[model samples]
Target: MNLLGRGALAPAVPVFRVFGAMNARAPSASLAPDVASRTALAVHNIEVVYDHVVLVLKGVSLEVPEGSIVTLLGANGAGKTTTLKAISNLLHAERGEVTKGSITFYGEEVHRLSPNELVRRGCIQVMEGRRCFAHLTVEENLLTGAFTRKDGRAAIQADLEMVYSYFPRLKERRRSLAGYTSGGEQQMCAIGRALMARPRLVLLDEPSMGLAPQLVEEIFEIVDQLNRNEKVTFLVAEQNTNVALRYARYGYILENGRVVLDGPAEALRDNEDVKEFYLGLSATGRKSFRDIKSYKRRKRWL
Candidate 1:
């Protein structure tokens, strides 16, 4: 069956591109004036601190234009998840807080909003690990995402069908307990649940985690479909650089809590450093683990 349905066209507006970290002195110059007006989210020189002591993110800044797919690429412990949590206002739950800088959603400062308040304003996070309620049936798990909505059942039911349309597999297993489903299905359930909230911006953390390559492709394909047809904006934090770059229009690379490099996806894909380090391919040939490890010490961005 066709999951994307009709009216799925490529985004009309060009993605606003920013390279390197935004200059603290000239932050306004990072994005073109026209493009800035269309931004869905903007994080400016933000710093995240855990336990009021350990710093996690340092002066990281980026933008996600409305109706576009943006990817955050990095290895484990690179602050990718922390950045998403900061944007979603989920940091307080873990004793983390944004100590500096500002975050804005749709041109309004939102760093101080509560998590559920953020959800009510149409921004939500589909957390890592597909955190589904294990005992809840698949459909029930999806319904939980709509808890903040005051819209009548008719509207909610229409959206439920819309979520099922994007994920027919969810419809097939609607009665099955979420814990009994496969990893891929659980990932779908997580994303489907976010859709039930009728979100405008979905912060997706590691959607490909623990899934097979084919399943990863399926998950990303669904994300693309949602962006194209439903006009949902996505900010995906992923470790799989190749796949993320293939689907995202723009990307930011994080390391040690700092944004070291960022640009249009095609530019990043062909970049020498990205090809050698992230893609495991150098001008000579594919490198072994030992070669990559040796090259890591001299990463140009460092």
Candidate 2:
């Protein structure tokens, strides 16, 4: 039941470990060696319930250190999205609420803040499925992320260009309707829009869903660039365990609304249980579909 006690998971492929050795950037606080002291966001034993009835999240707790990438990994329906929505205060829109515990951003309690208030505090969420406005031009969709800023037009425009620098493909498609762009381009737009907010923390959900493998790598590479260059912290919820581990410094695995396993990303990559269950690998090698199904029925951490 204690997966963290196991050996480290396998390392992600070479390309995915591009930023694995970079040092953590100092936040507003004095440089601290430990993650706890430098945490940008902390979710402490929070529980989320939908419509005051269906309990969705049960004591979910995780942290994202400032200027670091931390991933939440799990299968579909494992409460990854709910955890993100809880942090961004978007739960209220869906009739869901965090019924207990606390969520803090930059050490201030924020579970009660409005979604826009959270955004104003430099925290934002890019929802899954590339939620771009169908009728809006790609450039228009990116600019909307700046609505909360009181900063003048020059600053916002500068940030827009910065977004274009990171996502040149988006600039190429800027005049096109977001709904007309390819899935990968739309995903880039969603993230580009998040960048326009100048957020210190971005809670990204399922960024790789429905994109080709190459596109997934391209997107994550941009994430790496943003983290290193912009000092933006990311708390990513992704089903693509292999790619997520490659780019993130740390990872948490969720199941049925609870954190089942967590460790440094390299450790998670080499973990046998993670490889077997999430990555479809075992000590013996890649698992066949039948083997995976059989193994799933008897998951050790379940």
Candidate 3:
């Protein structure tokens, strides 16, 4: 059964152990504009813990600009999803908390807000898996995303039409139960549902997981289009560096709950370490992280 139930909440909060500690950030109310300022979401020196003991994020920090796509790259157990959950305020659903540091959206302290409140504030997260309401039709599933809105029916209808326009496959499958749809369609449904919220920022977690390369390309194209046309900012957490970087303007690589490397997407694509280790194109043929004895820690990602 789909754990999140039959509607907007279908993608239940992910449960996992956390891993770090860092400094704090004061709250701010002013959202004044500045050409030098482009941040939409900021995770500042955040430290997350589980059961009040096990640390998961150690002084982790990053920024997502208001009108660009940012990619978070990492392997399993690298704290990528945990970081997303922390930003969405979904950690509390799994008995986790950001013990230190501050999370802000548009200069406002949002770490204190509830998950739904975060949604209300133009921040929404699409979970790693293609989680959809198995029992509900695709269109009904999309409507659940509007539950938090007080907007009139016309605006909601327009948004729904917009979602369908973005995912036409979804419109074709509107009457189909989400569980009965293909992985790609379900993934589209998940993203379309988030779009229904008319979010300014979308925290996309592994949209390429379990999908074919072509479908991944198609999905990302839609995401890129959404960013370009609708001006929605995206913070995508993905392991598919090849695809993620292709769409993102900047990239951050996480390892063991800390940022190991970060740079412009194009720059990171040409980075020796990224090419040799992540892209599997070493001079001596492809080598796994475990097989490379000389790949020492360049620096402690504090």
- TM-score top scorer: 1
Q: Please list the residue runs of candidate 2 whose C-alpha ends up more than 4 Å from where it truly belongs after superposition.
A: 1-37, 291-302
- Winning candidate number (lDDT): 1
Ranking by TM-score: 1, 2, 3
CA-lDDT, candidates in order: 0.84, 0.82, 0.80
Worst 10 residues of 1 by lDDT: 1-10
Q: Give me candidate 3's TM-score against the actual structure.
A: 0.84
TM-score of each model, paired residue for residue: 0.87, 0.86, 0.84
CA shift at 182, candidate 1, in angstroms?
Answer: 0.8
Per-residue lDDT of candidate 2, residues 5-34 (tens digit)? 111221122111112322222122222223
Against the true structure, candidate 3 has what lDDT?
0.80
Q: For model 1, state the Cα shift of residue 35 in Å.
A: 5.8
Rank all candidate structures by their lDDT, best first, as comma-separated numbers: 1, 2, 3
In candidate 3, what are the lDDT values of residues 81-123, reduced to their tens digit?
A: 8899999998887777899999999989999998999999899
Once model 2 is optimally superposed onto the true structure by TM-score, how far is the C-alpha of residue 177 displaced, in angstroms?
1.1
The superposed Cα distance between candidate 3 and the true structure at residue 81, in angstroms, equals 0.3
